[model samples]
Target: MPTTNDELPESGRKITVTEAVRLTTNWRTYLDDSECDFQTKAFLIPIASIKNLLAINPDAEGVRAYIGLNDADDAMSGKLVLVPVVDGEDVIFLPGSNGDPDVENDSNVYDRSQNCPPDCSTPNELNP
Candidate 1:
């Protein structure tokens, strides 16, 4: 059975999606941490792409989506889907998934643009 970081052995590492799901059943907490609670909700990662992440970091902790750093007026919000890439004892966050149209065109203009980057001029690039 899979275990959370707090429940693992001294040499244990972060859990992968498969192991995480097997243990938690739901990916909500993982997803939430990645997204960083930016009023935006939900996360989407392709199953196939996970393999590349695994290859790069076999002991990766978990994926997270960056919701932008704090800025003036706290209006600088953007999404950066990431997968954990562990390098030795350091855990790095690697970019994963892309923007969703639904989020980009959300009824709330603030939330809409908040989810998209100003320089993001293209559609989401899906890994086929």
Candidate 2:
């Protein structure tokens, strides 16, 4: 489901605007089925207006903001989750040169579905 400006949370969205306008977030997703954990959620917000409303620099390059499921400050494990947007449309998160998902707590080859962040994009950029 898409998150419209009207649906923006009443709290935690630190930006405030005095004008009357509807800012709909162009929400996209790279949800890796059977991957990730309960500690996070990942998606793309591409609408320039919505980005501005969220206090992100609309002119800034790349998607650098992520909603934190634990802290609500757009990060998990002290890292920022960044997804890729090409031509204003969201693409799959590409992994950085280094990525290591933690399944060691109960590591199992069959449990590979739980490899967090889907082995794409660095740990923080793609993982929920």
Candidate 3:
């Protein structure tokens, strides 16, 4: 089981990854606009390409992505949203540097373990 809201200074609330996914039922609603308005190829890592590479080389280092997916067994849909945390009534993903998309697009996916930056060395604290 994954930890959620490991160190949220904003709310100081602890959460589980399952709960976070449940809260973000509409995670994909704003993705189109966000991608169109502020996007760069830097943050657009193709999932298929990664899989192909991994298949060829089993020793390959896989991506450390934090994806927001709907857990409804009846309907399956998921998108590569950034690291998300339960904040109040909303579940939000951290935007890239200065509202750009390149930050999350990097090869290093945000590490969801440990506390946030300046406090803990765990990486990828985009919105913490």
**Which structure among the candidates has the greatest TM-score?**
1
Candidate 1: regions farther than 4 A off:
1-38, 69-77, 85-128
* Candidates 1 and 3 compared by lDDT, better number: 1
Highest lDDT scorer: 1
Model 3 ranges off by over 4 Å: 1-42, 62-128
Candidate 1 residue-wise lDDT, 20-125, digit = tens: 5454434445645677443333234445556665666567665444444345354434444453535533334223424343553321111112232333335422
C-alpha RMSD for every candidate: 14.5, 16.4, 17.4
Please provide, for model 2 over 66-113, each residue's C-alpha lDDT reduced to its tens digit, 9 standing for 90 to 100: 433434453343233344444675433222322334532221111101
| Full-model lDDT, candidate 1 | 0.43
Instruction: For each candidate in the order shown, give its overall lDDT on alpha carbons.
Output: 0.43, 0.33, 0.36
TM-score of each: 0.30, 0.20, 0.19
The alpha-carbon deviation from the true structure for residue 121 of candidate 3, after best TM-score superposition, in angstroms, is: 28
- Pairwise TM-score winner, candidates 1 and 3: 1
TM-score of 3: 0.19
User: How many clashing pairs does model 1 include?
Assistant: 2
